[model samples]
Target chain A: GAGVSQSPSNKVTEKGKDVELRCDPISGHTALYWYRQSLGQGLEFLIYFQGNSAPDKSGLPSDRFSAERTGGSVSTLTIQRTQQEDSAVYLCASSSRGGVGADTQYFGPGTRLTVL
Target chain B: AQSVTQLDSQVPVFEEAPVELRCNYSSSVSVYLFWYVQYPNQGLQLLLKYLSGSTLVKGINGFEAEFNKSQTSFHLRKPSVHISDTAEYFCAVSAPGNTGFQKLVFGTGTRLLVSP
Candidate 1:
């Protein structure tokens, strides 16, 4: 079976520009998540979408960060007015029937974004 | 809220040598623990998890973690690590809320360097 995958393995942009990172979760995964990995902040959760419930955006650092899962499968994370602090590897993960204590999350290759 | 702490930022070991990566967490309520590994230029993958039933959880790539509730620790250990095992290890915790939403809180990660 195919695992989770992301597009644009690498992206470099200037400050104040906009960048979009995409993620495709495994088939039949009802729960999807976005995370950011950086030298300063480590790994931080960005957003979460489970089934049809409202997406959890609590982990989003700022208002400039937003994400949407279309048709409950693919998710896109958009960072507007990118800053140098936004330079990091954006990771995506998915799990089957999330919220369970033992559910395992499969991760994608990740999209490395560099904001100059 | 749950948080994970990995005190060791880096660990270097020789091939076929035993190694231990310490991890401690703080949480008011019961929590789920997990260990993940990330190779260079790749996404993170699950190493092991401790949800219930047993305190000792085994994972892939010859890795295992022991969850201790009294000490609030879940440390990863391997009897003899190989060169291929060199990677970054992360300890994470999650406490499901009333809505059963699980958001992982990860540590800063420990970079393990294996020398042959």
Candidate 2:
């Protein structure tokens, strides 16, 4: 079966530039999540989307970060006026259902975004 | 809020030797524990999960973990390791909310170095 996929495996942008990362969840998956992994650090939760419900934006660090899932399948994470602190690997994951203990999340290879 | 701790930043073991990665977590409510593995240049893959029932859970690639409620630990172990097992391992926890939406909190990660 096809796994979750992400675009732009590596992205380099200047500070103050805007960058967008894309994720394609597995078929039939109704839950998607976005996370960031900094160097020598664990993954940091960013946002979540489950079916038709309102997305979880509580984890967003600031107003510059936003995400949207179109048609409940693909998701795009946008960071406006990127900062050097935003340089990290952006990871995307999906599960068969939404909930805490519902299912295991399948992750994408991730997009490594570098802000110079 | 829940938080996970991977005590060891790195663990080096010889091929065919036993290995263990220590993980501990703290949460005020019931939680789901999971172990994930990330190979070089790859996304994370589910190694195992402990939701309920057996305290000892086995996962793919000959890995297992013991969930200890008293100590708040879910340590990953393998009898004999291979060079292929050299990768980063992460411990995560999630507390389900009333709406059935859960967010994962991850540990810093343990880097396993398997030498042949």
Residue A54, candidate 1: C-alpha displacement in angstroms: 3.9
On DockQ, the leading prediction is 1
Model 1 Cα lDDT, one tens digit per residue, A21-98: 999999899999899999889998888889645457788899999888888898889999999999999999999978
Ten-residue region with minimum lDDT total, candidate 1 chain B:
B94-103
State the DockQ, from 0 to 1, for candidate 1.
0.69
Q: B38-110 in candidate 1: lDDT tens per residue?
A: 9999999999888888899999988988988999999999999999999999999986644668788899999
Candidate 1's C-alpha lDDT?
A: 0.90
- C-alpha DockQ for predicted model 2: 0.68
TM-score of chain B of each: 0.95, 0.96
How well is each residue in A1-116 modelled by candidate 2, as lDDT tens digits?
Answer: 49999999999999999999999999999999999999855698888889645457777899999898989899999999999999999999999887656479999999999999
Deviation in angstroms for B54 in model 2? Answer: 0.7
lDDT tens digits, residue span B40-103, model 2: 9899999999999999999999999999999999999999999999999999998654455788
